[model samples]
Target: MSQNAVVDGAANAVDTQKGDYPDFMLKEIHEQPRVLRETFAGRFDAESGRLKLDELPLSTDEIKAIERIYIIACGTSYHAGIVGKDMIEKSARIPVEVQIASEFSYRSPVFPPNTVAIAISQSGETGDTMDAIAIAKKAGTPVITITNVAGSSMTKESIATLQVLADQEVSIAATKSYTGQLAHLAMLSLYLGQERGMLSADEVADAMAELEQIPAQVESILSETSIASIEAAAAGCYKAHDVIFIGRGVGTATCLEAALKLKETSYVHGEGYAANEFRHGPIAMIDAEAATPVVAIAMESETRERMLTIMGEVKAYGANLVALATEGDARAAELADHVIYLPQIREMYLPFTAIVALQVFSRQIALLLGRDIDHPRGLVKAVVD
Candidate 1:
């Protein structure tokens, strides 16, 4: 059932009980595999290697006519949009711009011919996202909303609603819902690619096969031994006053989401920068005395070499380095003070496994620092304005 079918739905489910897990955030984090499965169920055909995104209202001609796509969202949803932008552009061969909803609503964004705005929200009631959707619709653009909660404002406002099927995310810090968004966005991108003839049938099939493996891969990451290792790493670095996450390409979204989780849950000052962009200015913050924790997301990707170089630079600066590398990556292990090994997936899909590791690390840090991980201070489940 969608969150809307639940007792109170996402927006009012703040009092939702944390059944067995001590905190809702941890519980929700652990729920990602099942959430992803739910989101993927019935949407993909393994037999034909086709995506059945019947929920998408855009016809093939309409999708091909799209001049640009603007992805508008806020906070964790915004990070999901970043990932979505990458997936859509790379697979569908369409230019996509990810805009922070608050800024997008105020900015004079030009809606080119057949421009589409995709607004992502967990609660479907974020004030800024809804406003941005309104602005897009005012320009005669068909706004598609990817949201967790059905029957919420965005669902009604959008021309079509793509439910991520994460089912009532109770934690103020998003976990399962974010992964759900990624899964749906992946499917949406593939669907668009197939429709536009940008991706071949075999290519989509291969990607679908890879996508199908994500749930079991996530289960492997959530295993007791893996969680123990992540928690141990978190115990070591939770005392740091500041943390930096760096990556490139799709890893950029992973870094941004990881940093946000650390900052929001643990109250540590955390920042995310593209690895190449860091050397420009942010690298100056690193020093031995401070021992700032630099979490490098060197997940297996085209950017791994560059990330390793940046990790070397971080080590040279005397900063404590925590590397999220694919399993058995000796180079990352060689340079990192601590390494959280992740299950190796496709470069574009690494965010799924990589972010889960960071979520666990962030939760452990919150537990160590005695912060309320579920309902962090000064943050709410939905920024309803």
Candidate 2:
């Protein structure tokens, strides 16, 4: 379908209500804490410190028999799969391949015995994902789906379904749904890990304890003080025609989603690159004259110092530098032209809090540019085809 057709169809098809909030996107962004809570509820056993995904039909033996996993989705869901890939591999000791559903449908991929396919979609009706699920089923793989809507097409096709419980996301650019997917992915990874004997009860408990705090941390990010800082950061870059987002490790997936949000809402050219990959060629685009903004995810991690070095290079090139740093990082504050401080959490979990800032930043920039933040032009809530 053409972009113009998509825009026209979205106008008539989706709900554009803002209610008490100024825009649907912002409303969805603020609803993330509740979304996270709902997604995690009844999915964990506090007494045993293990995940209880009774909804998942795969037994312990079935999970243990899994040799490989395929995560198929597109756009934001694909980025969520990237985060899931790392977490599942570390926790479940299983290899995972994250694929774009549209591409995967065309490729003659091999599905080894005992393999499973996880299909992620905010709307269970996404056409490419549904097609990919059909392929997986044909290959005799059990399909598990993570989605917002219960009993949707994807759910009907899958052996088991994990509902993200995000409710109705009215905005074309998804906010809470993406977070909901992450929350479910986190739980599913832990569930698989414990069932497969890769993670102990104590380890699961420690992770769950940290995960439980994410809702509160995200709520803090939506606070007035945090919103003001994010607005100020957005103000610094809203005029740019192009923006660059860079991160390492799981932060890289966060960068990809953040960049997509910016582009989708504001009609700006936003690109995400791995921090080290920036120097390969993208760094040359950073010019003093253009003042291209480089948003760096410089949170506390093993690669933080390297991130700092890259920030120094960006500054040397005279590009505006925006950093998402851990709370109370003096070095990051000094190095950045604008800083959105994220709550102190382990690097793996930082995506929950850090992406909130970028979501607000993208919305603020859209508002500043007088763009429709809720239903962005040429975009739909779901791309069925």
Candidate 3:
């Protein structure tokens, strides 16, 4: 039975109770595995090699005709769009452009006919995102929304909805929703790809198989042993005034959101840079007395070797290096001052697994700094206004 299912003996019946979990943030963070499973459940047919994006309004021919995709969102949702950019482009064989809603709103945009615009919002009430989609609709673009709230205003406005089953994510940091958006985006892309005849059945099945193992891998990362190691690493880095996260490819999304979590919760100067881009300017900030803590998402990918060279530059300036490596990557462990290993998964799907480690680590850093995590100062739960 799912966590939401009613037990025979229970009166209230369900997993609403927090049990012994103290902080809502921690509870929400750990709840991701369950929510992710829930999000994909009943949507995939393994034996038949089929994906069901029944929530998608457009048909196979409509997907085939899409010239491009424009994804607009804000905050964590925006980062998820970056992840979507990679997924949709590769899977569906289409070009994708991701825009921050506020930027997309003021700009005079021109989209070719049959272009689909996706506006992602957890609350379905972010004013800029709402406005961006409104403008897209006016220009005769079909809009689809990926949101957690069913019967939300955005859902009402859009042609179709991919509602995430994260339920109510009470914490302001956006844990499960980010992962949920990624899962939905992946599914949508694969569905489109299949319909468009771009992806083979075997390829789809392989990706689906990898996705099925994510919840268990996430569980491994959230385990007591894994959490203790990351907590210890955070304890070491908590005193640093500036924290930088660097990665390439899908790791870019990981670094971007991880940095946001740290800055939002702890008031630390946290920034993310593409592994190659870091050398251009940000690398200069790693000098003595700078005491910057570097969190490198060194998960194995085509860019793994390049990330190792970036670490060389970081070490040259004597910065404290924390590597988020893949499990059993001995070379990464050898190079960095500390290592927080994530369970092995496909590089294409690494962001979904890798970000969980950083999320847990950053929150522990916030707690070590004694910050009010649930109600971070100067931050609103949703940017509706």
lDDT of 2 by residue, 1-385 (tens): 0101100001113344777998788888988998787666566687767778777766789889999999999999999999999889989999999999999977898999999999999998999999999999899888888888776888878777777767788889988889889998888899999999999999888888888889989999999998999999999999999999999999999999999999999999999999999899889988789899999999999899999999998889998999999999999999899999888887778788888899999889899999988778888888898
Residue-pair clashes per candidate, as listed?
Answer: 0, 0, 0
Query: Whole-model Cα lDDT per candidate?
Result: 0.87, 0.87, 0.85
Of models 1 and 3, which has the larger lDDT?
A: 1
Residue 40, model 3: lDDT of 69
TM-score of each: 0.95, 0.95, 0.95
lDDT of 3 by residue, 90-186 (tens): 9998889999999996778888888889989998899899989889989988888888877777877788888777877777899988999999898
Candidate 3 clashing pairs, residues 3+ apart or interchain: none
lDDT of 3: 0.85
